[model samples]
Target: MKRFVVRLLINSVALWLTTLIVAGVSVESYDADDTLATVLTYLLVGLIFGVVNAVIGNFIRIVAFPIYLLTLGLIALVVNALLLLLVAWISELIGFGLSVDGFWWGVLGAIVLGLLSWLIGVLLRPIMGRSR
Candidate 1:
């Protein structure tokens, strides 16, 4: 779907920005110096992240709704960080993907990634259309 593709692109851009800004959060591609390879790697990782978040994340959110409310939604940061780590582990199994230094790094990286993705999505919404 168009919306899914747009979201994937936004996630790729967000992940790219996170790697640039967060030293501890880096992505390694098949060819480190190849820009196209790096971009595709990011896109592929982003897709994996999205899928993992959509499935596992939704389940966690539903089960942990009470904690989420008690924390005033701050728990989402932790959840997102865990999701990032999950993605990292999954990517590692396949080789050539994201590498997060630690839990704190994953937390910081997830925060920045979420912000960047939101900002990019907001900016592109007009062009991409409100329905999406």
Candidate 2:
């Protein structure tokens, strides 16, 4: 439970950072004037992203194993980008969530988001006492 919360927060931070660094990827606050609403929206979107990646993303990765081998893992970038786009689509359907400008932007945002999440996770692992 604690580990799950930690990962969620890490993902939220990564998504927030991506918004700052990636111009084409951004989250829309449910309440435009409310700071708390904006933060919570990011966290919620992060949660959606985690769930989407864990479920659909895993299935797709498993099915695309051959492509992964053929591309020497470079296909991971495309996979991640597609996952991000999926998250954005899901969020949009639900009313408030991420908005990706286009395919290439999604790719770049996914790359940065992955790096940020990985770095943050590594930094937090010591304090979090490792994941089970």
Candidate 3:
């Protein structure tokens, strides 16, 4: 499925931007003073993020849809927060060392992440030069 794979890659890029925006943490390191390693590390982190988001995010969103609708979509924010928390949990499990500060941090992170995703999608849709 080319479409699914494309979406998966986009998700990875989005997650990378999220970490860049929220944590200011480095993703990978190769040497004592190698920025390239850090870049690749982020790419790896992005892949992990995409997997966790794809599998876990789907379940969470489905279960929360009614709450989202009832709150006139306000609950979508909470849902996104929990999803980020879940990604942190998965990262820890996989030895990636990511953790949300708390529920409030997660909420703020989710909001920022959503905005970043929107901006990336808007700009990338033109750059990738794909018409769909």
2 against 3, candidate with superior lDDT: 2
Model 3, 1-132: lDDT tens per residue?
Answer: 665555555655666666677763223333426766555555555566667667877787788778878899888788778877776676666665345778877887778767876677677675555776
- Per-residue accuracy of model 1 over 65-115 as CA lDDT, tens digit each: 999999999999999999999999999998899999999999999999999
Clashes of 3: 1
Model 2, stretches more than 4 Å misplaced?
A: none
lDDT of each: 0.95, 0.95, 0.66
Better of 1 and 3 by lDDT: 1
Q: What is the TM-score of candidate 2?
A: 0.96
Query: TM-scores of the models, in the given order?
Result: 0.96, 0.96, 0.71
lDDT of 3: 0.66
Question: Candidate 1 regions off by >4 Å?
Answer: none
Worst ten-residue run, lDDT, model 2? 123-132
lDDT of 2 by residue, 1-132 (tens): 888899999999999999999999999998989999999999999999999999999999999999999999999999999999999999999999899999999999999999999999989998678535
**Residue 62 error for model 1, in Å?**
0.9
Q: Model 2 scores what on Cα lDDT?
A: 0.95
